[model samples]
Target chain A: EDQVTQSPEALRLQEGESSSLNCSYTVSGLRGLFWYRQDPGKGPEFLFTLYSAGEEKEKERLKATLTKKESFLHITAPKPEDSATYLCAVSNNAGNMLTFGGGTRLMVKP
Target chain B: DAGITQSPRHKVTETGTPVTLRCHQTENHRYMYWYRQDPGHGLRLIHYSYGVKDTDKGEVSDGYSVSRSKTEDFLLTLESATSSQTSVYFCAIREGQGYGPLHFGNGTRLTVT
Candidate 1:
């Protein structure tokens, strides 16, 4: 079975603080790793999809990097509005279902 | 923003009653998935549909069932509501094949008493 684990169940930071969230996974055949941001009471919003190791993708203040065994979502100088739960998920080459991590709840205090 | 919509934004029901949630997508995506989000457990898939009338079970699919009679609508039904089934249900969609990113609906909050 494919499993995903995210570290630092919860994180708190200042308005301009920069930090990174980790997502570790174990799967039979790595196909793609995904990052999503979910706000309170809303569904998860798509962030990025990393297909291969050493691949990196960025959007505004968020940068997602993937390695063979894990992925990291780096938040650069996050703002108060950036506060949300970040989710990581992975799908194997043989499966269509995504195994999701527990998620990292981030609080950016102003 | 992929035009996914989940109905019954909030629902309150009693145990032993049947409940059905609807997920509609305007983008004509080929794949639709039903997932439940709980406090401790992350998003766990309940069921998924690859095409019309094509359905499959997920990791946590014991008490749930799904149907996809149309190309744009997918439905998840619980045989009997239970307190343990209270969760935020989200529907996700993907257009083509491959391991592409999925776009999710706003979610439906279900509370079983």
Candidate 2:
């Protein structure tokens, strides 16, 4: 069974604080890993996609890194506007359907 | 935004009543998906259509049904609404497999009383 687990269900950080959210997965063959940011009362916005281990992608203050069994979303100098629920998903070799993690809710206090 | 739109952004319905949600996309994508978001369960796929009239059940498709008569339109129907079904529903579309990202609609908020 393919499963995705995100750690630190919720986190609170002051402006400019740096932290990382973890997403671990168990699957037969990893195809791709996706990251999304969802705000309150809105749909999720696409962030990055990692196809292989040791791959990394960054956008502004967010950086996503992937490994053999897990992925990490690191937030650097986060601001209040960056506060949102971060989600991670993985796809197996068989299909395009994504198995999503429960998400990590981050709150940046200014 | 991917030119995706979900009708009746907010809806309140009574339990046992049948309701339908519409997802329309102008991007002409080949894949469409329906998902429900709950407090702690994350987003669970209800159903998805790979092409016109080609739909499949997802992990949480017991109480939901989907129809895709056209490439740009996908509809989700709840045979009998229940309190447990009250949640925000999102629609997404992908151009093709391995494209990496899905364009999502703003989502519809449904409340069953």
How accurate locally is residue A39 in candidate 2, as Cα lDDT from 0 to 100?
90
RMSD of each: 0.9, 1.0
How does residue A38 of candidate 2 score in lDDT?
Answer: 93
Cα lDDT tens digits for candidate 2, A60-102: 9999999999999999999999999999988788666777899
* TM-score of the first chain in candidate 1 relative to the native first chain: 0.98
How would you class the docking of model 1?
high
Question: TM per model?
Answer: 0.98, 0.97
Summed over model 2, clashes come to 0
Give lDDT: candidate 2, residue A80: 98
**Predictions in order: lDDT:** 0.93, 0.91
Which candidate's TM-score is highest?
Answer: 1
Lowest lDDT block of 10, candidate 1 chain B: B94-103
Model 2 CA deviation exceeding 4 Å by range? none
State the lDDT of candidate 1 residue by residue for B8-113, as single tens digits.
9999999999999999999888999999999889999999999999999998899999999999999999999999999999999975787788889999999999
